[model samples]
Target: MAPPVVPEAIARDYNEGAFVLDRSPRASAALARRCLEQVLEGYLSATGSDLKKQIDSVKEKVPENVYRGLHGLRTIGNFSVHLNKDTNTGQIVDVEPEEAEWTLEVLDLLFDFLFVAPARAQERIDGVNSKLKASGKPLIE
Candidate 1:
């Protein structure tokens, strides 16, 4: 199974974002933002009524870089939601060059920090403990 942090539904959202990135960067960015919020809400139990507040709630718990990335994704996603069109001209305004792509990159980093690293560390510990059990030695606590 995939990592528990990103359930299948969330992954699907992220993939859908990637699939439509070229045609509609704003849409892609919106999806990325949704996925990030889901991860924060579902896994971290991030508390707050809105994305910005939720991110602020978790700020002290995560490293500076991770916190910055979360805010970055939030900012970019806000652009997708709030700034996608010209209010006066009624014309679509595309995301800044590579801005949509950067959201995806930030998600990858968040996933690595919150999920993959912990799971891999547990796997290594289990492997070593199994050997210790076989040899009648105490397991690593």
Candidate 2:
């Protein structure tokens, strides 16, 4: 089945980035970074400020695995961002395709963990609760 559309914008960015990975790794990395930022923003419920600060502030709140994934994405994407910066000579260095590919792979895992799995679990819980209510039975723990 297709994934639920919880965060549409982030999904769009991720899909577009994956689509263009081969032709433009730099672009792909940028989009993946934006996807990561959006996920962090929504997860932390803190925004409109420095992303690193927001992430740091939520260090204790986020699950260890999610935090690790976020840090990995940031580290890989930082190379893309730094290389994209214009030199004093007005030249931009592009990221290697491998870096962009890795970012996408991380995103795939994050999408399932951060969005899809929780949603599916909630759906299942709700379904069970609904059935219990209809049957005049206690809900499952």
Candidate 3:
């Protein structure tokens, strides 16, 4: 599969606002959830393991606090998919913008660490050296 494109707009929003600032919280949350789903699916596909089992294993492998944080993110993502609605008004009552931004930020970091950084770190370092040599910009130094 082709690599995922990190959303430039979201990065810009994060850089400018110190967080993701798009107002569509539900959409952002859904996107973050989708990213997590993709990662889990990829992991399962590679390892031929069930996602739930893998998550359980991960919980055992990680520290309690870290596992709790992951569990909380997973819960937020799951609830963002299944809950957060008013039956009468047909409005979403629980999905918060801050929560969505936070989820997205965490997902971005996870993706960068797990997928992008390992794949591109060497290339980026070389590119930085090349650019520095060409322009004397001291990109690394």
lDDT of 1 by residue, 1-141 (tens): 224656788888888888888888888899989988898888877999899999988887777888898898898899899856779998876676489988888888787877788889999999999999999999998
What is model 1's C-alpha RMSD? Answer: 2.9
Off by over 4 Å in 1: 1-5, 84-93
Q: Against the true structure, what is each candidate's TM-score?
A: 0.85, 0.75, 0.52
- Shift of residue 58 alpha carbon in model 2, Å: 2.5
In model 2, what is the error at residue 66, expressed in angstroms? 2.5
* Candidate that scores best on TM-score: 1
Residue range with the least summed lDDT across 10 consecutive positions in model 2: 1-10
> Native-vs-model 2 lDDT?
0.76
lDDT per model, in order? Answer: 0.84, 0.76, 0.56
Q: How close to the true structure is residue 53 of candidate 1, measured as C-alpha lDDT? A: 93
lDDT of 3 by residue, 3-114 (tens): 3544454344334333233666655565565555565555423222643454555554444554455455566666566766678998866667777767755655555655
Backbone clash pairs for candidate 1 read: none
The backbone clash count of each candidate, in order, is 0, 0, 0
Ranking the candidates on lDDT from highest down gives 1, 2, 3
